[model samples]
Target: MFVHLTSAANAPRIRRSGIRAAGRGVRGVHCFPVLPSYTLTHQWVRELARFGTRGGLVAVHFRLDDAEPVTVRHYGTPGERTTAAEAAGRLAAMEDPRGWEVFLPRSVAAPEVHRLRRPPQVAGWRYFPGAHGRRPCQCDGCRVRGEYGGRRLRERLPHPLDGPPPPTRVLLARLAAAGDPGDSAVLLDLLHWFGLRRRRRGPVAELARLAGHPDPQVRRRLVETVWRWSSPGAAELLDRLADDPHAQVREAVADAREWLAETD
Candidate 1:
């Protein structure tokens, strides 16, 4: 059940008896057979191309009666010849549990593998209009700035604010109008992608007004974004930043007033 071998010496010699094996990978192995179903016979697809190689990407998973467990991924061309009527027409099209139908093979010599298969799940509104909002493009700051090409979404915009301005409220108003210290390290990575530890209200009051920022690393990422958004009055602004003269902004405002008095 749930097998996914890519090639670890063409695995498959388990004749049931509580077959086990769990997980292994860099190319395959994952078993679990208390039986009740089974049938990958024909000596398991002639021992899966003797541990697949030429372009590697193999797979397998079994179960036929007690059902559920059927995967397939071999790519062919190593010593090609995977017949038995092409492994029973790819095990009857991976026993139709909605498997087998993978396309994306066209290749103009790998045009970035078709943008690595339609990635860019949006960040900084890649092609705007709330980049199709409703937390569209599966926001996590639009999938980590949609893994490059938008280069951390044009360095988390708001530089001089012209285009792209909807990602988590224009990167929390350009980290409260970043005034320097290299734009406060891109406004502390746009307040660590706006999940400023479960944010409470608009970028934790613009990181508590950048804890009187002058740039002690933007007042230590504004007392670590108010000890990770424990925001509401963050212990009365870390008791007026424990008289900061920058001993690392008074030890990050006495560690955000001892982590908001140990989480109150």
Candidate 2:
């Protein structure tokens, strides 16, 4: 289970568990504040120890990415510092003085203690929500920006993008054109819709025909779409993309080729 320090009251609960804070602002190190027991329980620390016992590492990630503290600023008393995983591993080894510090990202919010199921990557994670601010922020012209409709300044930005792609036939026809550079823009938009349905094999032959389109952007999109399709012809199409003029397209082709080589 993931716990969210959404308010000032909850922040101390996390701190009392032996978590400490260092550095200024959100850029410093913070601990997950979990303690271990030999036996397992529903409690988060016991859960963390159980996970760490299985060769997983634990770390406390914050919700906000910036230097500002979304909840209570101070975490706990000063102590030996290291990342959550490192601390969890040390504790799991049955070491004394069970505590360590985790470095908070300078500009990214990562707010959770999750199991690193895979080696070198914290793959499995649970996210917690922070409480909304009661009043408008005053720092760095935040209030002024809000007065002018800061985040939502654009009228139709959300509605249109969240909605559907315009039309398929129109986009496909525009993409089929021989050498018109301007048509590539329309195709790029269409790719967004098609890209989402990557699980389904759709119109592979028509897309493959444009593999040699002069515009590298269109060809890049084609390479991505072809990678998703599990068609028998996918290998041959990707082979052609291997020699694409654009460095990016060739890189995508290299990835696809490696995937095929591994899967086959």
Evaluated with lDDT, which candidate comes out highest? Answer: 2
* lDDT agreement of model 2 with the native: 0.47
Q: Give TM per candidate.
A: 0.21, 0.39
Q: Which stretch of 10 consecutive residues in model 2 shows the poorest summed lDDT?
A: 122-131
Question: Candidate 1 lDDT, tens digit per residue, 35-143?
Answer: 1223332113223333334433233444323322323343231222232234335545453312122111111121111111111111112222233444324333443
List candidate 2 segments past 4 Å from native. Answer: 1-159, 166-170, 176-182, 259-264
For all candidates in order, the CA lDDT equals 0.42, 0.47
Candidate 1 Cα errors over 4 Å, as ranges = 5-56, 62-264
Candidate 1 accuracy as lDDT: 0.42
Summed backbone clashes in each candidate are: 0, 9
